[model samples]
Target: MNRYFRLCIFFFFAVITALPSQTSASWQPEITIGLSQGLSGVHLSSTSGVLYVYEDLESKPILELPQGSELNVRILRDQIMANGQEIKGDQLIIQPGADGFIRVNHAPYRGYITLLKRKGLTVVNHVLVEDYLCGVVPKEMPPSWSAEALRAQSVAARTFALKNRKRHASEGFDLCSTSHCQVYEGMSAEMWTTTEAVNRTHGEVLFYKGEVIDALFHTDSGGMTESSENVWGSSVPYLCAVIESQMQTQPWERSVSLDALMQKMEKSGKPLGTLKEIRLSPLSIGKGSGDRSLSGRVRSVLFIGTTGSVVLSGNDLRSIFSLPSTLFDIRFRGGEVIFSGYGSGHGLGLSQWGAKELAEKGKNYKDILLHYYSGVTLEKLY
Candidate 1:
């Protein structure tokens, strides 16, 4: 729309994100990253803390785990079984069923273990019922598809985590398959290839001296890729620009070039194709990021500006969707937004393009990770 409107939306996101979450920070730990395995009852546990599962009420089970999947399990709480049984090492095996659940090897659910959950989620890393997204690939999906992309995702993410272990630089990287990144589910025919994708990527996000220098990826949403610095204020060496044809096929086309968008805007007053109303204020940060993609991609409402470059986030999104507001450590300067966003991510940290670039270059998964996440190294939790 107008430049004033864009500025208003930018300020809105900044203020909203800066505010406190409804739940205290202590209640929710920082960045609970959950790894979704296609199988039921099994999930990757990252970000040492408690776990919570995202499941629907009807299908929700008190205890849920994945079957045939292996994840390191550590007990956070000590419990004496009703039968007076004491567990050992505060650790339990995570056994899942084909139908989906964490099969309790020891009755009375012995203890609690820290597991990885989605971003901006609290309630001690737990299970995701329906949110554990897994579905068949569109019948129209290219025949060349073979779960290769998702496998690459796991490998890249894991590699980044591994190499950056020494410095604990886990900030930029995120768990894939969530709305924030890729959608991974091992069981579904669509996501069956995630394991192989990970094998291909090797979870390595390369970095220089602890700073994630490179990591590129592609999501079904971001019709195009993004520049990491523009989003997270850091340079992701490999993600300079993503080509259009390489864009993933998702309902929402994220890649909008300023030059190309200018043509569309010149004909139509709207800069973006979605044209969703947004609130540009800092007051919208902690309103539960409702109806949002699990990755916190949805905000009340906010506007995108026409400018050289601006970092976008969930809060900023509020301005476009007519949501509330928030204040964060980000700044949005309006120029000619020109519908330039090519991806749906916060556009920070690790990018899909950067990941693919590394993968193509024969960089092992771990080596790729070290290139992006600065000052970190890998350590197998198992």
Candidate 2:
């Protein structure tokens, strides 16, 4: 009997090894996004069919509402109340029927809606990663852009979402729906073009040395991108700076009065009373100098004032003055400090405008991605 059992086990192993490897369709991972937080109450409705409400971890539906039915959820002390009735649990999951979508405060969203009472009522969306991207790509980039550009944006967004999946874990979700995470407007933001891009690049991600990359992106890169070390003070091999050969410089200018600057400094807890002079190196593109990054972005600035002088980083200045970018020249004129800069964002990773230019020049999405993210491989995770 032992010999027969061993033979059966050997045969089972052989059959298993002989079968082809495949990722199951159901293996698609879901991402939870914090839609709203600290809400006293929220309204929900079904868009197409019935909506099933379930308590956390329960398969059976606790409440069901037909089409057009509305439910009001609120928090009282530590309890969850729905439609004037107190729910037994602190969390409630709302799932839609076939081809149905749930609307939270009139904004329709794909996948299940979860309401959790943490401090106050929090609304979350539990959506498949791909479905989430459909809402993201359009908001991050114009849906009217080239197909390849859209496709590239899709991959980058997906990789970014996956890499930062636990960014808001302590806040009870994977990410937020604002620009702090990725601007996600749910079903309302989905477009046919951008959705196609997400579908075409489904399960695709940018990987560096077997791991997914952060895949940071921005609005424009001016003429050159900055190294990760220069921007975030950490060296990432795959995030090395690259020059956009076909791209032209995008220049911007802003001015702030010295008095305004002093007030801003005081508000920021760094009281620089009566600004006397601004000392910064002249702006030079694609080269690093003292107080400047390799991409010519201001790394630090020496702010001289009458009361006391304090040196501030370029990012701090950007926040204080609402400047477009850190790559700028500071000049004192009359009662105002003029800031003339290039680019629009942090000047790291993929530049959206640069991608559009490349796509218009006949480069595919892969080419665009490779040009921005050095030494990375595109892999289909699913």
Give the candidate number with the greatest lDDT: 2
Give the per-residue lDDT of model 1 (tens digit) for 1-382. 3434533553453334222222213311122223322112322331223223222223333333233333423222333121123333222223233223332222111112222232321112122211122221121122233343343345444433332222312431224334343333323333344434433433233434334333333332233333455445566555433323333322231233345544554454445443323343332222324333222233333445443222335444434432221112122224223222224334333444444555566665555444444454443221
TM-score of 2: 0.91
Query: Compared with the true structure, what per-residue lDDT tens digits does model 2 show for residues 248-268?
Result: 478888988877878889988
User: Where does candidate 1 stray beyond 4 Å?
Assistant: 1-144, 147-151, 163-192, 200-223, 246-315, 318-343, 348-382
Q: How many residue pairs clash in each candidate?
A: 148, 0
Clashes of 2: 0
Worst ten in a row by lDDT for model 2? 16-25
lDDT for every model? 0.33, 0.85
Estimate the overall C-alpha local distance difference test score of candidate 1: 0.33
TM-score leader:
2
